[model samples]
Target: MQIRDLPYADPGVADARSGPRFLLWLGRNQLGGQLKALAWGLLHFCGVAGLPLGVGRAVQAVVDRSGSALALAGALIILCGVAITLGDTMLHRTAVTNWITAAARVQQLLARKAAELGAALTRRVAAGEVVAVSTGDVEKIGWFVEALSRFAAAAITVVLVCVGLVLYVPELGVVVAVGVPVLALAVLPLLPRATRRADVQREKAGRATELASDTVAGLRVLRGIGGEELFLGRYRQASQEVRRAAVRSARMWALISAVQVLLPGLLLITVVWYGAGLAQDGRIEVGELVTVFSAVTLLMYPLRHFEEIAMAYSFSRPSAKRAARVLALRRTTEPSGVEYGRPSGDLYDPATGVLAPSGRFTAVVCGDPDAAGLLAERLGGHPAADPDGAASVLLGGVPLDELALDEARAAVLVQDKDPVLLSGTLQELLDVPSSGKVSAEDALKAAQCGDVLDALAQASVDTDGDGDGDPMRTRITERGRSLSGGQRQRLALARSLVTDPEVLVLDEPTSAVDSHTEARIAAGVKELRAGRTTVVFASSPLLLDRADRVVFVHDGDVAAVGVHRELLHGNAEYRAVVTRETEEEQLDGITAIGELAVLEEIEESA
Candidate 1:
């Protein structure tokens, strides 16, 4: 395919059986492109090999003092030059196109795999390895793919040139033929060592990249804990190891390069030396000797491709293996080819015996924050930390794993306690694949963040003189770090509200906001999601009171199920987990609740 028409529609399913199989699969998919490149490469190398023959013919013509023969030989040389120019140009163009297209295809596959695995990808594979596969590994794989066809053409040209030399002057041709393979295969012995060094360098580099990624991701936390220097020192040591490994790899490759040059030089010397004896013995003409020497010299050029192909394969092999390993990871809730459409029943976790009734607001109170987080993820069909022990979440009497990935994601949306906001425009952030029932403006209002819109618009106006004061146009920094914690939390809540899924599971979504805003947000959510199934895993009284039903999960199972006030009065354990109030203070809760309401009203009015 052409470069402009790149990024194949499917990229097809990858063969993740092994690294070599994956590499072969990639090659098979691009056979058409490789053939085109190979054809052009053959023309180029043949044109180059034909040049020495043209020169030898012209020299013979000059010695004969024949004007017409000399003129013909000159024209032949010009024709060879034209062929070389045309063939070389097209060959390079096709080869580069092949390289770019192969890289694009691999990248598309990686992207598809990443989308399939989501956050689970990092848990299954190292983030740095994934990064390396998409970056350095992709280029190496493409390089090998592009180099293969050219190497094939070069090898063919070498064989043809050797046969031609043997036919023209069998005496020198025998030595040249024997010596050429020796030159090509001479570097084979050092390749294992070179490849091992390269692998070490690649491993070191991946570690360094992973360390840097982790450090950057937790930079704010690192600074808060005064551990920046510790991480920095660790990163520095990793970088030094990478540098040392790279140097060792480079040295081995340099040695191979030296051998490539030296062996070819020795072959050229031998061909010239042997041909000279033949010339002096009158067994070969002066012109024939020149032709043999020139042909052997040209043969060295194509033979270099052997070493290049070896180097390319060595580097790309590990990269392909790493990529294969990542792509091979399957989610625990992955589809089983069952057709499940539009889930419409209670969301139940059989493992925890917790049921979120259909079309009702349910709040789950878990004392352990980590357990609550795991429950939220499981509710959305994502496996918890201990996936093997956790049972599949069921919706509408169907296990989530039976549904397609798209269907499962659409049926349930989970907002983790620590939701991340990617860097983009405000519009882009809210532009999720959502049910059209809820509008962005309405969702923002329900999230109780109208002030966030105003702040965004004002920020836009300040940044750009010609701003139309559109909040949607405002660009958010990475992770929304430029905004306050409350603002980021509210915006994320607003985004989730926009989705308006069949079932929404929120884990302490308002933990960053104040009690006043949290109360308003709870009311807004209750009003907006009146008829939908929403599960909020939280302990706040405001949120729990708003729920149609409250489930108190003790240890790892459901302990009690009731309304917030009923649980507070009847279950002392539930009251302690929800409000952390002593028995004496509980008697005065009515007066405290009245005071809180009065303060909320005053805050609202102000």
Candidate 2:
């Protein structure tokens, strides 16, 4: 593909069965660019290889005292120079183009895969791994891809130069030929060790990156809980491990590089020493001696490409494997293209036996936070395995997995308990694909986000000139760390509300807010989402009391289902889960209050 056509309309399906296969697939896709680079490289190295011959002829012309021959030799040298200049320039251009194009294709494919998998991508792959693959791995994969064509050209040029030397002076040519191959192959024994070292370094680096990502993501929480030093120490240890691995890997590669340099130097010394002897014995001409020396010197340049190609492959192999692994992951909910226009029914998970009735507000009280999260994920078709037997989570009697992915997503929106607020302006965050019935302002109001907007505006003022006081234009820090947990929650809630999906499953949406604000938010949500299917997984009395029905989930199944008050009074488990106060504690607290009141009355009477 042309450079201008970069970011292919489709990067095409990758052969991600293995790292090597994925690399080959990338090579095949960029065949046109590779061919162009190969052609230019051939021209370039061929020019470079011809230089010694031209110089040899000039030396011979001088010794023979032939002016005509000397002029011819001069012309030949100039011709070779022209080819070298032109070919080298174009070769570099094409090589860089190939590198950039390959990198772009990988990035695009990654983006597409991320979009396809959505939240499931992180669940399957570590966040740090994903980051490393997209950033560092892309460049490594591209480096090998571009190196291939150049390496091929260099190899062919070496062969041609060797053949030319052999034909010119069979004795010296044979020696040079044999020595060159030895020099090239000597580094092979060291490659496996070097590759191993590199892989270890990469693995360690990935762990460090994951640790850093996790640490940064939870820095606010860590500070709140006064666990900053603990995480910081862990990250420091990880970083040190990465550094030590890198040093070890660097030492191994340095040894390989030294071998490559030292061996080639030895070969060059042998050629010069032997050729000088041959000239002295009158077995070869003095000019031929110069030719052999110059040719060997020039050959050293292309020989470096061999070492480079090895290094590139060593680094990129693991990178390609990581990329392949990520791309190989498939979504559990495979879209079947089943045309179920605007799914309208209860969101049911047969696995958990939890159901949120259509067009009703349902509250789920799961005692286990982990179980609640899994249930929320299942509700949104983000499970590793499709809930079979009934096919998957059914919406309106139609399995969510059976529907188109986009259709399913549009119909059901699940906001996890710890919702992420991506870095963007307030307006951009709320610019979701919505039903359009609720405006951003209305969504914000319904989510009780006035304080968040004000905080954003105040932040804007602190950063910029008196800041237009427009929260919509305020720049949020990455992951919305600039805001408090409560503010981030409110903003995320507003964003979700703007979508107005048919079925909205929210897990502890108001957990971070105070009781008064939570009560108002409960009312706001009830009023705004009236007549829509909304399932909130929370045990807050204010939120639960507002639900039309409450479903108490215990041991991954619906243990009891009724209004919040009825369940709270009738089901001891449900009451304990919600209130966290046993009947004995309640009686003791009441008795203590009555005794205090009696003492106060007697004292006043006395």
Candidate 3:
């Protein structure tokens, strides 16, 4: 089956079952491929089991008659060789197919779940855990899945070979039958301990991965603050801990391996010693004795599979649990009876007593940045305010939580100050998914991205690849690293404009740009979003001036709601804050001018 045809849809089932149950579920789902693999595996094992019997028969035939029986035995031996080679080849091919297909299915399922959850996924599970599960856990799961059929085939072959020996040579068969189980079961007692150690190793690895991801993501900030050394030291400590855990895990596995080898060797010795006595009593022929010994030797190969299966399970169980935990995270609770149709008008957050009436440009001006952030979250249904309480965000009187996920998401779009830029080209970056039908050119014009387009054009001219004339087709590095901070911010704003949701909630959108650029953006935004509901959370006077209405948020509540001019004129506290900010800017300007004057004087004196 194709990987695309695998069951990737989120099943919405909690993974609260035991490891064995989960494995069983996987087997049951991939039953077709699994059964085929098992059949081939059985055929392969039967061929292997037939080899010793053929050899023993050939030896006995040579001892009896010299011509015809020898020829028949020779033919049997040649057929056994051909069968074994063919069976081994088919077995390996089928087993590998099963492994790859199972891994692909799990990966598809995880990807679908990630899409379903969106931003809510990280809120539920750590980024590191998700990374681990997708990369490491999926592979281990496939290993165990593929190993299952081989394990079954090996076991069945051992049992059947032992039974056949009992029928053909009863004295040696009893010894072989009894010895195999002891070897397989001896490792059982070590499994629980090994599994526990494996769990610890996985946990440590996850923690180390999380620390490394965080450190790398924040490396620039840490370096700027001269804390790189400290973070590096911490990472070194974490790496050491992982090393220690790994050592412990390795030690357990080594001990299990040693026991696996020692027990099988002991079983072989016991069988040989007991069989020799039966042979002396003339109860078994020399050829029969050789066949029993060869069968035991062949049985050793399958017994090793028992060890391998045990080890694979021990390693894979924790990974499966982690994947299960990630899949179990619910994206949203079931919607109530409050049917959410198209929003009528306006967005209101009853919690902060803030409302942005529909089809109007609203600006939220908060004195405290933290309060502004919280207000933005509330407005966009991010924190998802309590339903029973009076602190709910509503779109056209429908509670945000009560609305279906698609409806709620389509109704409002929250653009943060530092927006994430996924790896793609400039055109793909601007073409984010949204219900509102807005063109890329229109959004670009609204964001005043002439300079951005120019930069892309310059890059395209310098680039030595085909189709380089299209500036929009230029590949952007992950998180738009090729772009400057202000450029990235503006590009993000343009993308949001392209979405053009009913309510566009932006938090400090132009905080990274120059005043001239900020002014142009403010004017362009006002003109582009003329008849839509756009809320800008900023204390910038340039943006505040263009808003149709500005709400003064103080101490987590709306202090006043009016035009910028009205607020500036009336509210003394608001006036004091704005006046202080303007004074600081003027003071900074004067200091810069003073420095320039001193430099001019020095040049004149020289």
Residue pairs with clashing backbones, model 3? none
Q: What is the C-alpha RMSD, rounded to one decimal, of candidate 3? A: 5.6
Instruction: State each model's CA lDDT, in order.
Output: 0.87, 0.87, 0.78
Question: What C-alpha root-mean-square deviation, in Å, does candidate 1 show against the real structure?
Answer: 2.7
The numbered model that scores best in TM-score is 1
Residue 592 in candidate 2, Cα distance off native in Å: 18
Question: How do all the candidates rank in terms of TM-score, highest first?
Answer: 1, 2, 3
The TM-score measured for candidate 3 stands at 0.88
Q: What would the per-residue lDDT of candidate 2 be over residues 284-350, giving only the tens digit for each residue?
A: 9877877888899899889899989998998999999999999898876577876778889888888
lDDT of 3 by residue, 1-606 (tens): 544555545433434365666666777777877777778777777877887787777777776756776677678778877877877887788788778887877787788778656555665687877888899888998999999888988889888998998998888888878878888888788889888988898888888888887788788999899999998898899889989988998898899889878877887787788888887888777678778888888888888889889888888888788877776665344557576586757888887788898888899988887667657766776542223354558888877767676777788888876798998888888777865567888888778788888898888778755545676888788998998998889989999999878889999999999766787788888888888899999876667767899988787678999987677666755654544435564544543344335434543542
Q: 1-606 in candidate 1: lDDT tens per residue?
A: 898786688899999999889989988988998898889888889988988887887888887787887788789788888888988999999899988988998999999988776666777787877888899899999999999999999999999998988898899888888888898889999999999999998888888988988888789999999999999999999999999999999999999999999988988888788888888999988778888888888887888899899999989888888888887877765577967668779999998999999999999999899889877878888762434667688898998877888888899998988889999999999999988999999999989888899999999999999999999989999999889999999999999999999999999989988877887898899899989999999998878877899999999899999998788777778877776776776776763465346546744763
lDDT score at residue 528, model 1, on the 0-100 scale: 96
* Superposed Cα deviation of residue 553, candidate 2 (Å): 0.5
Pairs that collide in candidate 2 are none
Give stretches of model 2 more than 4 Å off.
2-6, 224-233, 281-283, 385-391, 457-468, 586-606
